[model samples]
Target: MSKSFERFQRRKLISSYFSVTLSIALVLFLLGILGLLVLNTKKLADHFKEQIAISVFFKDTAKQVEIDELQKSLVMSEYTKSAVFVSKEEAAEQHSEEIGENFLEFLGYNPLKNSIDVNLNAAFVSTTQVDSIAAEIGKRSFVEEVSYDRPTISLLTENVRRIGLGILIASAVFTLIAVLLINSSIRLSIYSKRFIIKTMQMVGATKSFIRRPFIWTNIKLGVFGALLAIVALFGLLYYLDLNFPQLGVLQDLKMLAILFSGVFILGLLISLVSTYFATQRFLNLRTDDLYY
Candidate 1:
C-alpha cells in the first residue's frame, strides 16, 4: 500500500508540473498579442499619414500663368511631396462623377475653378503643420482659398493620440496583472512541492542548492512558453495578411521582424521575471507558513 501511494504521488507531481508549464505558456501568448497590437497601431497610423492629401483652390478668374506660378511656389516648398494642376474642365468632370449627377448642367456652365491637388510629405501631415502650410499657401496673390477636411484631420490626429495613450496605459496595466497572476500560479505549483523543499532543508541542503534545480526548471519552462507564444503570434499574423490584402503594406520584412522579435522578447522577459519572483517568495516562506 505504501508503494502504491508513492507511485500515485509521483504521478500527481508530474501532472501538476505540466499544468503549471501550460499556464505560463498561455500568459506569454497573451503578452505577445498585446505587443502585436501596439506595434501595428503605429504602423497603421504611418500608413494613413502618407495617404492624406491637401487641396488648393484658385480664384474664379485666375489666369493660367498665375496658377502656374502658384504651382511652382508650392513645388518648391519644403513640405510639398508633389503638386499637380487640375484644369477647370477636369475638376468639373471629377465633381460630376463624384456627385453622380451633371452639376455643370444645373449651373449652366463649368462653375468649378481650376485648382492644384497637393500631396504633402508624410512628416508634415499633422494638423498644426498642415494648417501652417495652408496659411503659407494662402498668402499667394492668386490663391482664392486653401481647402481641406480640417475637422477630419483634427479628429484623426486626436484619435491616434488617444489610441496610443490608451494602448500604452492598458499594456502597462495588463502586464502588471499578468505578472501577478503568473506569479500566483507558480507559487501554487511550488506549494505542492513544499514537502520536497522541507526535506532538502532538513537534509543540510543549502538554500542555493535547493534553488538551483528549480531555477533551471523555471528557465526551461520560460523558454518553452516563449516559443509557443511566438508560434501563435506568427500564425495569427499570417491569417490576417491572407484575409486582408489591404494590410499587405504593413507586412514589410523589417516591421514583421521587429514585431516578432518584440513579442518573443516580451514573452521571455515576463516569464523569467514572474518565475524569479515566485520562486523567491516560496524560498523565503517559513516552514510554519508553508501550510498557508
Candidate 2:
C-alpha cells in the first residue's frame, strides 16, 4: 500500500513538470512566430515595391541611337533595377492585345511612342523619389514624357509604414504577455512544492542551499522547453517554404538564428528570475502561513 502511494505521488509530480514545460514551449513558439514576421517586414515590403515601373516615352523626332543610349544609361543607374526598351510597333501590338482591337487599324496609324520601362530599386520606389527621377529624365531632349502610377506608390508607402508600426507595437505587447505567462507557470510549479520548501527550511537548511536545486531544475526545464519551441518553429518554417516557395520564408538565415537565440535566452532568463522569486516567497512564509 505504501509503495502504491509512492508510485502515485511520483507520477503526479512528473505530470505537473510535463504540463509546465509544455505550456512554456507553446508560449515561446508563438513568440518565435511574431519575431519572424518582425524580421521579414522590410523584405516583404521591398518585394512589392520592385514591381512598379516608370515609363519614359520618346519624341518621334528622337534618333534611335539617342533613345538606345538613354535606355542604357537608365539601366546602369544606381536607382534602377532594370530598364527595357519597347519600340512603338511592339507597344502598339501589346495595346491591341489588351483592348482586343487593333486601334491602329481603325485610326490608320500607330499612336504609341517608343519608350523605356524602368523598374526602380525598392529603395527609390517612393512617390517623391520617383517624381525626382522622372523630372530629371523629362529634361532630356529625346524624352517626350516620364510617367508612373504616383497614387499607387504613395499609397503603398503609407500602408507599409502603418503596418510596420502596428507589428512593432504588437510584438512589444506579446513579449510582455509571454513573460507574465512563463512567470505564472513557474510560480504554479513551485506552489505545489511549498511544503517541501518549508520542511527544508525547518531542517536548518540555508535558503541558498534550498534554492540552488529548484533554480537549477527549473532552468533545465526552461532549456528543454525552449528547444522544443525552436524545433516547432523551424518545422513550421520548413513547411511554409516547401509549400509557398515564392514567399521565400527561410531565405534569411541570420535573422532566423538571432530569433531562435532570443527565444532560448528569454526562456532561461524568465525561468531563472521566476524561480528565484517563487522560492523567496515560500522561504519568507511562516510555518503557520504554510497551512493557509
- Kindly state the number of residue pairs that clash in model 1: 0
Off by over 4 Å in 2: none
> What lDDT does candidate 2 reach at residue 211?
98
Model 2 weakest lDDT span, ten residues long: 247-256
Best by lDDT: 2
Q: Across residues 105-204, which tens digit of lDDT does each residue of candidate 1 receive?
A: 8889887778898988766788899999899889877788898887877887888899999999999998887777667766777777777887788889
| Backbone atom clashes (below 3 Å) for every candidate | 0, 0
Model 2 score (lDDT) = 0.92
Off by over 4 Å in 1: 1-10, 60-78
Instruction: Give me the displacement of residue 255 in model 2, in angstroms.
Output: 2.7
